[model samples]
Target: MATTLDISTTYYKSPLGLLRIGGTDTYISEISFIDHLEEGEYQANSLKGPVTPIVIQCIEQLIQYFQGQRRFFEFPVFQEGTEFQQRVWNELTAIPFGKTISYLDLSRRLGDTKAIRAAAAANGRNNIAIVVPCHRVIGSKRDLVGYAGGLWRKKWLLDHETKIQYGVQTLF
Candidate 1:
């Protein structure tokens, strides 16, 4: 006999875009942006096999985040990655909600400034989006760069966080 994991998925319409949320009953596994919601997809409100509590919580937190009423998330997330990638993703969580860290800085934090490219690669491979917060990483020169969700969305997220944290908008 083989064991199987029961995963529940739901969709959330966020201010940034449509998000596909997936998870087991205990922990959220993924929250990636999608260009469109596929037909017959289970939305947050749909009764689909007793929707996971964590998934609902994720959607609620995301909603609060977009509304600027929440800064940090409380739901647990589980992403599968290599040991190095795990380290990089873990470090990303430490980045303050509205603060940005350069790839060089992230690499240095990982104990090797030479691993900048590796760090950036790990950041890019992150499956969970806002909660893991890959958008907080930037270029060493403070330039906006490399976002799987698109640079425009990255810029918007940065500006939104800045406005919420500092009462002013960021130009970059």
Candidate 2:
């Protein structure tokens, strides 16, 4: 019989709030805020089978990130999305922590000057959150735009990154 991917979940209290982290025996299948994850969705998924080492490692790294002890991550992540979404996410990671990019700019970098909406949608559906660096995307005309974790969280994250870069203490 084919082996099923084992999954598990736990709550992580961060500056943003409580985040739900889920993973399979081989990798993290999903990570989202409590409000973002449909009720029972994470629980149902975590029972699918043994936890993966990579996922456990991701969990540890996430804790470190939340504690502000780590800046960048070096872990394997497994997420499901379209090829275009994956491409957009790849570009998001390249943005570097503490920097911001306009959605239109990101679209152009992806070679899709007309796919701004698609780019935003891809960012909206990003499951890996900070790891994928989706928060780095901003509106071309404004300081903040739509964020799955809320605009306040977006601002806090950006400001936190800025503080870290400038050697200033973050209020959040």
Provide the TM-score for each candidate, comma-separated: 0.90, 0.82
* Number of the predicted model whose lDDT against the real structure is largest: 1
Model 2 segments more than 4 A misplaced: 1-5, 36-51, 168-172
lDDT (tens digit, per residue) of candidate 2 on 11-93: 56666777767776556656776656578765565433344576668878877876667789877676778899989988988
Model 1 C-alpha lDDT per residue in residues 1-172, reported as the tens digit of each score:
1112476767787888788788877888888888754566544433434578888899999999999999999988888889999999999999997899999999999999999999999999999998999999999899999999999999999999999999887847
Clashing pairs in 2: 6-49, 7-46, 25-51, 25-52
Clashing pairs in 1: none
How far is each candidate from the true structure, as Cα RMSD in Å?
Answer: 2.8, 3.7
> Which stretches of candidate 1 lie above 4 Å from their native place?
1-5, 36-49
